[model samples]
Target: MIVPVILSGGSGSRLWPVSREHYPKQFLNLHKDDASLLQEAARRLDSLDNVAAPTVVCNETHRFMVAEQLHQVGVEHARIILEPCGRNTAPALALAALAACQASASARLLVMPADHVIKDEAAFARAVMQGQALVERGRLVTFGITPYTAHTGYGYIKRGEALGEDGFNVDAFVEKPDAERARAYLENGDYLWNSGIFLLDAKGYLEALAEYAPDILEACDSAYKAREEDADFVRVDDERFARCRSESIDYAVMEHTRSAAVVPVDPGWSDIGAWDALYELKAADDTTSGNALHGDVMLHATRNSLIHSESRLVAAVGVEDLVIVETDDAVLVADRRCAQGTKHIVNELKASGRRECQSHQQVYRPWGHYRTMVLTDSFQVKEIVVKPGAQLSLQMHHHRAEHWVVVEGTAEVTQGEGHGNTGDMKSFLLSEDQSTYIPLGTVHRLKNPGVIPLRLIEVQTGTYLGEDDIVRYSDDYGRG
Candidate 1:
C-alpha cells in the first residue's frame, strides 16, 4: 500500500497577517468555506487504491494544530511526527520514509507538502497513479507541473527521455529564473514548474539517501530510533534531530540520483505563497473582474484587489491592484504586484521583536484556544474555550489573580494549595452565568467535564500577566 507523507513545516511569512509563524497557512481554511489546505491534502488521496493512512511531519509547535485538523478530516489513524526544530525537507522526508518502512516493509511513500492546493483532485490522483507506475520500475518520481505562464515563483524541471506513457527521465533541475528566463522557459515547451511532489519506494529512498546524503540519513535514523510516542505525536530526540543538516530532497537525493524521473501534470496546483496567489485563486471563481473580497468586506471602485476582513467590516475605495488584510492586531496593505515580497515585512517585524509576526491575538493550546479581548497596564481580559473533557494544568501564578465567568457549558473548578502539600482543595461545578475567583499564588485548574465546549471570560488583575508566569505542577498535555 502507498503511504502518504505530508510535510507541513513552513513559516509562511509572505502570507502574513493571516498566516503567522505560530499558525501558518497550511492549517488555515483560507477560502473560508472549505477545508484547510492540510485537511484537503489529507483527503486528496482517498480516491486512490490501496492507500493507507497518512503520516504528517510538522514542527513541535504545530503538533496540536496538525492533529486537530486531521481529526476534523476524520483521519483518525495517522502518525504525527514532531520535529524538535526546523531541519528542512530532506530530513523530514527521511524520517517519514523510516516510519513508513517500519509500518510496512514494502511501503511506498507518496510524498507532498501540506500547504499546496490542487483544484483538480481527479487529475492529481491520476498523476499519483502514474507516479506509482514509475516507482515500480526503480525510479524516484517527482511531479513537474505543466507551466502555462512565465511564473518566476517556481523552479523549473526539464524533461528528458520518456520512460512510460506519461513519465519522463529528469534531464535537469533549474532554479527560479528571472522574468526573461521564465518567459523563455514558458515559450520553450520542455520545462515544467517543480511541484516538490514525489513518489518513491520507502526502502529504496532510504538506500539512496544513505548513498547520497549520509549525514542527514544517519542523523534521522538515530533520531527515529530514539523516538518516543507521546499522547498524539511521535517525539524525536531534540538534540539528535538538531544535529541533522537542513537540506531539501531535491538537493540531497532527487537531483543527484541517476533514477530521477518526472511526470508532467496540470492539476491547477498552487503553493499559495502570497496574498496575490489567494487573490488569483478567488478571482478564478469570481464573476467580478476587479475585487476578491473575503469576510465582512465592502469594496468600491476597487480594480484588481483583495480585501480580507476577519473580525470587523472593512471598506476599500478607489484602489487598484492592492491587497488589504485586516486582523485583530495588525493590518497589511500592499501593492498586489509586490505581494510576494511581503516577507520583508515579516523580516522587519522579527528584527523589531514584534509579537504580531509570530502569533495572533488568539492563541491555541492543547485544551482549546483563548483570545485576548482587552489589555491594560495591570489587567487583561480574555475569552477562552475549553474542549469537552479537556482541562488546564494544575498551575499557579505568583503575580496574578483571575476572575472567570462561565459563559457556556459547565466548568469543573479545582482550587487548592500547590505542590502536593494539600490545603483548601476544593472542587465545584459552575454553569452559565456563574463566576469564581482565583487569588494570587493559589493553585487552580479549570476543566470541561461536559459534552460541549466550555466558554468563559477570564479577567486578570496582576502586576505581570505574561504566560511565562505559570508554574505548572501537573499538565495533561505534557508541557514543561
Candidate 2:
C-alpha cells in the first residue's frame, strides 16, 4: 500500500500580499477554484489503487487551516502532524516516515509538497506507478521534470545508465545554471528539472536517512516518540525538534545515497513560485492577456500581463508584461521579470513592521473570518461573518469591551452565566439590529443560531484592542 505525505510548511514569500506568513499561496485558490492547491494535491491521489488517506505535515499555525480545508472536501481520517518549528524537508519527511511506519510497517510513502500545480493528473499517476515499483525494491526514487525551457530558476538532474524500462540511475544533481549553461543542458537532452517529489518505502527511507543524516534521523525519532496526540493533531516535542538541524532532503539524503534514482515525468508541472509562472499557466487571449484570479478587472491592449484584484476594479491600458495585484491593505505592481524579487520587498516590509506583509486586513478564524473596517485610538470597528452553527471562543478581555450588533440572521448570545457557560453566565437572544455589550472581564461567547451566515458589526472600545488581550475561558475549537 502507498501512503501520501504532504509537506505544507512553505511561507511562499515570493508570492506575497496574496501569500502571507499567516496564510500562504498553498492555501490560496490560485486557480480560482473552490479547492486549494493542497486540496487538489490530496484529492488527485484518491484514484490510485491501494492508496491510503494522506498524512499531512505542516507548521503549527497552519494545522487548523489544513484540517478545515480537508474537511470541506469530505476527506476524513487524515493524520495531521504539527511541527513545532520548521527543520526543512529532511526532518519533515523523517517525521512523516516515522508516522507512516507506525501506522503500517510496509507502506510506500509518496512525498509531495502542497504548493505545486500538476495540470496532468493522469500523467502524474502513471509516473507514480512506475516509481512505486522501484521504491518497493528499496530504491530511493525522485521524480524529475522534462524541461520545457532553458529556465535558470530550478536545479537540474543528470541521468546515468538506464536502470530498466521505467527509470534511470541519477548521475548527478546540478545547481541552478546560468542561461548559457541551461541552454546547453537543454540541448544535451539528458538533464531534467528537479521536481523534489520522492517515493520510497518507509523502512527503506529510515535506513537511508540513518546512514546519510544520522543526527536528523535520531532527532526525528526522539521527537516522534515523545509526541503527544491532542485532538486531531500530533504535536512534536519542541525541545527535541529544535535540536534537529535544518536541511533539505536533497542535500541531506538523496544527494548522498547510492540508491538514488530519477524517474522522468512529463506532466505539466510548475512550482508556481512567482507571479510570472502563474501568468504562464493562465489561459491567455489572442493578445496573450489573462486575468488569473477573481475581482473586477478591465484591460485594453494589455498583453502578457497578470492582474489580480481583491476588492476594487482594476483597469489597465497598454500594459505589457506587468503584474498588478490589489488587496484591501496593499497593492503590488511590478515588471514580470522582477516577480522573484517580491521576497525582498516582503523582507523590507517585515523590517519596517508593516502588517500588510504578514496578513490581509481580513483574517480567517476557525469559526469564520473577521475584517477590520475601521480603527482608532478609542474604538475599533469590524465586520465579522460567522459560519452557520459556528461559535467563537468563550473569552474575556481585560483591556477592551465589545458591542455586537447583528446585521443578518440570529445570534445566541451567552451573556453573563448560563448552562453553556462554565461559570456565572446570562443568556440572551439577538436578532437583526439588536445589540449587546460585553463588558470588560465579562466572559461571553457568540454563536450562530440560524441556518444562514451570521453577520455582525463589532464595535470595540477600551484602552487596548489587540487580539491577544482575550483570555479564553472555554473554546469549542480547542484553542487556548
Error of 2 at 414 (Å): 1.5
Q: Which stretches of candidate 2 lie over 4 Å from their true place?
A: 283-294, 417-422
Model 1 gets an lDDT of 0.91
Query: Candidate 1, residues 254-302: lDDT per residue as tens digits?
Result: 8899999999999999989899889888876556665788889877777
Backbone clashes in each candidate structure, one number apiece?
0, 6
State the weakest 10-residue window (summed lDDT) of model 2: 285-294
TM-scores of all candidate predictions against the true structure: 0.97, 0.96
Q: Which number leads on lDDT?
A: 1
lDDT by residue (tens digit), candidate 2, 1-480: 889999999998888889999899989988647789998888878657888988999999889899999998888888999999989999999999999899889989999999999988889999999998887667999999999899888999999999887799999999999999999999999999999899988888899889989999999999999999987799999999999999999999889988999999999999988888887777453333454545788888877778889899999988887889888888899998889899999999999998888788889898889999999999999999999999998887888888999999899998765223456676778999999988777778899988999999999999998889978888987788
The model with the greatest TM-score is 1
